[model samples]
Target: MLQIDLWKRVLIWALVVAGLVLASPNLFYSRVEQHNDAVKAIEASGATPEREAQAAAWPSWMPSNLVNLGLDLRGGAHLLAEVKVADVYKARMDALWPDLRDVLRPERETVGTVRLQPSQPGELRVRISNPEGMTRALELVRGLAQPVVSLTGAGTSDIEVAGQGSDIVVTLSEAEQRATDERTMQQSLEIIRRRIDEVGTREPTIQRQGTDRILIQVPGVGSAAELKDIIGTTAQLTFQPVVSRTSDAETSAGVGNEVLPSLDEQGTYYVLETAPVVTGEELVDAQPSFDQNGRPAVSFRFNPSGARKFGDYTAANIGNPFAIVLDEEVISAPVIQSHIAGGSGIITGNFTVEEATNLAVLLRAGALPAGMDFLEERTIGPELGQDSIEAGKLATGVAFALVLAFMFFTYGLFGVFANVALILNIGLMFGMLSLIGATLTLPGIAGIVLTVGMAVDANVLIFERIREELKTARGPARAIELGYEKALSAIVDANLTTIITAVILYVMGSGPVRGFAITLGLGIVTSVFTAIWVTRLMIVIWFERRRPRTIEV
Candidate 1:
């Protein structure tokens, strides 16, 4: 039992060497991080002399990845936002109006004139001038309904069309609403992720909460307000045909049209078509650039389909003006000077360079389908984070020292070997974490502390069993062999159960709790390897070299 095979010895030492190598970079985290950042900046922009020197500070062959600090540890902002899913329902209904009108206009003589009427939220109400043709009108509307593809609502239609008296009430069905909510939440999550990723924040958590809410945690952001400023705006950009331009705020554009106030110019209102000619969804790319007058502006290009439609519209209405609306506010109403065939255009307004850059970023990330209601927002200060980190280090050091002292007092030299293996176990855990780029939260520190105690249990079990065997009159080597063999099942059972719990926590938990689970789970694996392989290897080497007649534990 003491002698290991040649390959097994090689494999164990190789793993130890790899762990140490991977874990070494964390000792100089700030320097490596700065070097990595400088390298990325150089790659993004041109490699200037200063940036080249900064990049040269760390060698190219050295590992640059560090264990990412969580939002709680790094100090950042946390936001819980609830998506306005019902808003999509109204939009769906509004979008349906044009198609419905186009389909029913030809049947007007038979089905009567279909006039839009006020109804409940998420419902499209149409009043029929002729009451007798209600059934036919209902049939026509029902024909436009599509099948809902949701797993839970496979057999249902997308919308429920019903007629009461002289009106038809069109509402999104149970299936469609569920599908819409899922789609909206997915889009919201993606957009939020893109927005955060665009800013290059480290290890941001953008995840969905429940059915309609999203939880966002961004490290290194100044405040909740600052984070909100980056991604809070819906940035709903639309190009709507201009109906009229006026200075009167009270000027109503009548039915099928709406008036919006100018964003930059005071008292200027623009009456525009309710339906957009092109939306931000059609945008393929957007960048901050300069206008003809050298003013800050955003240039955007649309996809092929959008470009074709835009080109056709511009070609037909060269002298007419169109309003560029952002989040329902009119940015500008510019005349179509020529046929814009390439699907690219510049948006000019009273904008600073920063404003133009941010707008471009928003446009590139795509528009949110619905608005978000921020339910909770908070900022964690860097000072508090530093305090937490310092306290955690102190606690870990104290725990490690106490454990080593106790092990040495009880088992002498063997306890020293166990302590060495324990330290390596922690090193291996951190190496795994750095390799995987896992975030270390405050709870994750607690996990490592818990692991320090757990890591020594297997060694204690084997040592106690060896003591028991010695008391029973067994030879020293035989006692040691039986001790490790007998303790194997018990150690495996204990670690396996703990690992199962950690897995459950990781799967079911969120944010900091999940971070704790990750560290705890990795700690278990590393501790098991150190106990079974590393500690055994150390004992084998000692026994082989000494050939002691009698040994103390």
Candidate 2:
């Protein structure tokens, strides 16, 4: 144990140096955070003189990533929302009408005048004038169904078709509903993430709860209302062919067309084709811009596929008006004066600059799959967060001091070695947490305190074992070797068991629970490393330098 290899000594010291270097930033948290924010600002906008000066304040080689503080520590908004998954069913049925009608059009004689009828939600009811053709109509509709892709639903088709006398009802099958729900949840999650990220806030936790619920926690936001405002707009933009223009409120809209009130015009309404020529999903970018009329407008550019489709439709219907609709309201109906091939257009609306900017943000984020009903909302104040931080700091300092004192008094000079290792162990823990960008919560402080107490356990075991070996006929170096060798198994078993428990907690829990697991797991690892390697290295170095015939450990 006294004769350590050159390579091993270098590696161990290198790790200690790296830990201290990485953990140094947190000691001066405010300055580093400011430097990081300034660098980001400079990167976003071309470096101004002020920003360049600010960036120079912090060294380039220093690590900029900090341990992100959780909502419980930083204070923010928490919201629980339920996605209206059922709304998609009604939309699916509406969209299927055009295809269903076209498929049965050729068989009008056989199907006997197919007509849509009032039905329950999620069910499409089509009445046949003659009951004799019900079977053939059902067959035609069923032909449109596609096979479900999921493992549990591999054999079933996407739609279920049934016929009763003269009427046929079509509804989404179990497999299709499951697939649709998954898609809706994913879309909702993505859109929410985009909306939040656009605002340039710190790490936000957005996760799915049960089947239909979502939990959102955003740090640094003032209120839940602010968060809601950013993501509330549906912003479903679509370009549809205008079927007709009308001033009468009660004007009849024919089959496969919808009548929507004009957004700007006082009393005008437009009947537009149900099928969209292009959707917001095709948009690649959107920005707030001024139109030719010097009014607030949003400029948008479409992707390659959308450009091709838009160009073809515009070329075919020159001089015909097309309606630009947003959220089921017609924003404008402008005639195609000429072919628009570039897939870039301007939307002129009665909007303020702020409104235009918000619209651009929403359009860039894409539309939500379905509406969300806010089930619960909470605003955590900064005062509470400050109090929690103070409490955590006090608790950590007290625990650290007590652990230091206990180790020093218990093992004499050897106890001082353990205390040094204990301090380094904490530095390494913070270094790891900072490196991984883990969030720190209130419970995480408790985990660190528990780690401080547990870190000395291995050192205590080794020292007591050494004392026991000394009572027998053994020299200092051999007793030291046996002590470490015997304690190795216990240290490995204890730390591994704690780490496994932490992993389980993290996998099964969320939010604050995850924060505790992360700190606890990292603490266990750093503690074991410090107690086994660091303390042992100190003992070996001392033994070699002193070369004492009789030593008191």
Candidate 3:
């Protein structure tokens, strides 16, 4: 005979899981101010083209919303970016053919004109007048010696322009195609992350899923329409127009910073200026750090050329403040007190460590190649989120009560035992959510409710089978034994199917769908233990103590 204490053991296990789930979220990132309002969630960047923009990702405490609410159910921006494979191929050709032309110094007498075209595998085609010059060009290309940093491939087939007449087209070698794919995918992701940072996406999550596909999720974004405006903008960048501050009077290089005045996008007057310093193009990496007194700062390393330029510039203007301008807001304006000879330096500002570190990640990723297109944007008011959460709780409570009542009325003592286990199952799921630190969306609450309603199905299967065994005129002990044994196969099959389905959903889906799948998956495992072991132990204990010779439903 099973002991009543056995059910208690399973119940206790359930409690431990519940406790863990409830304590997870607060364990990560520390915060300065709590979020009280979503409408005023973040400081407004004032207004733009009749629309106001707010930081939608997370609080200043966390650089990423890696654990925050996703779009759909919480609502935010969605964007799709397609890397320019064609432009990549074009750049390869442009860089290659020029060098190949220089190499093919086919005696000017042998060839009049050499033309280039595209081919498969991202190779370029080069053609020269006079078929005989092809041999010379090919030979020159074969023997060509120089570093082709971004462009690759050598020899006749690599420079494959074998058509008729004076023009030829070159195709990319397989190696070149492979290299470009990697560069574009990596660069595109970094560029998107940078633009999001520049525009102040608090904790935006940008990841690459496939070769050319990137997935971006920004939480608390209030304007999806604005995101559509930003996401598609090519945003290409380069180091151009390097001029001294004295070159333009209107551009102004004011000395002695007694609050230098500047203009905002609206052409309004504002005091800003620490004079012009070098742009961010030459930066290699940046990280968030703390100073000697533990104040927030940003540290950065530069490329060799940039280091030389920086050392020279600081040596020349030791007392002048150099502005660290980003997205047109002067982030910092520190005086160049001495040479940064080691090619690395730090940016100190009125910043929290998180904010400073995020800025470094942005700078390391480099400026966007072009101005952004806000493909999507939106925000969730905290009031609404809180209200919805409360409503979900009420709904879950009602569902649980209804399920408990139905099960108890139908199955009697065993049903009561299932009810107790179900409560613990609920607690376990919540505790795990807290422990795992998953963001709870409205759909996630629905998942919990659905689990509550469906979790008892397994218990019902076992109980009903027990009833069937008793109808065969079996003794109480024999009935309960056969009941659980006979039903185990069907129980296993059903739950396995449910688990597989959840796995497929989680694997293929994103955002809320994924959240729903996780909750459902966890529910299945918890339900099996409660239904099979906890409920059975209670039933057996009751039978043993009461000594009921005949079973009662």
Q: What is the TM-score of each candidate against the true structure?
A: 0.92, 0.90, 0.60
Q: Which one wins on lDDT?
A: 1
- With a 3 Å backbone cut-off (N, CA, C), the pairs that clash in candidate 1 are none
Kindly list the per-residue Cα lDDT of model 1 for residues 1-553, writing each as its tens digit. Answer: 4678989999999999898778887898888888877888787556888888888888899787789888877899999999999999988887787778778888889888988776677888888888898878888989999998778889889999998898888999988999999999999999999999887788999989899999999998999999998778889999999999899989978766789999989989999877778889999999999999999999999999899989999999999998899999999888999999999999999999989988999999999999889999999999888999999999999999999999999999999999999999999998999899999999999999999989999999999998998888777888888899999999999999999999999999988899999999999999989988999899989999998878897
Give Cα-based local distance difference scores for all models: 0.90, 0.89, 0.62
Q: Which candidate number would show the highest TM-score if scored against the true structure?
A: 1
Off by over 4 Å in 1: 45-54, 111-120, 127-133, 163-168, 289-296, 337-342, 350-353, 469-478
Off by over 4 Å in 2: 45-54, 112-119, 127-132, 163-168, 245-269, 284-308, 342-361
Q: Ten consecutive residues with minimal summed lDDT in candidate 2?
A: 37-46
Candidate 1 vs candidate 2, TM-score winner: 1
True-structure RMSD, every candidate: 2.6, 2.9, 10.5
Sort by TM-score, best first: 1, 2, 3
Per-residue C-alpha lDDT of model 2 across residues 35-55, encoded as one tens digit per residue: 887888776546888877777
Which lDDT tens digits does candidate 3 get at residues 145-219? 332235454332333334445545455555556655777777777777766766655457677766666667775
Q: Which run of 10 residues does model 3 get worst, by summed lDDT?
A: 235-244
Give the clashing pairs for model 2. Answer: none
Clashes of 3: 46
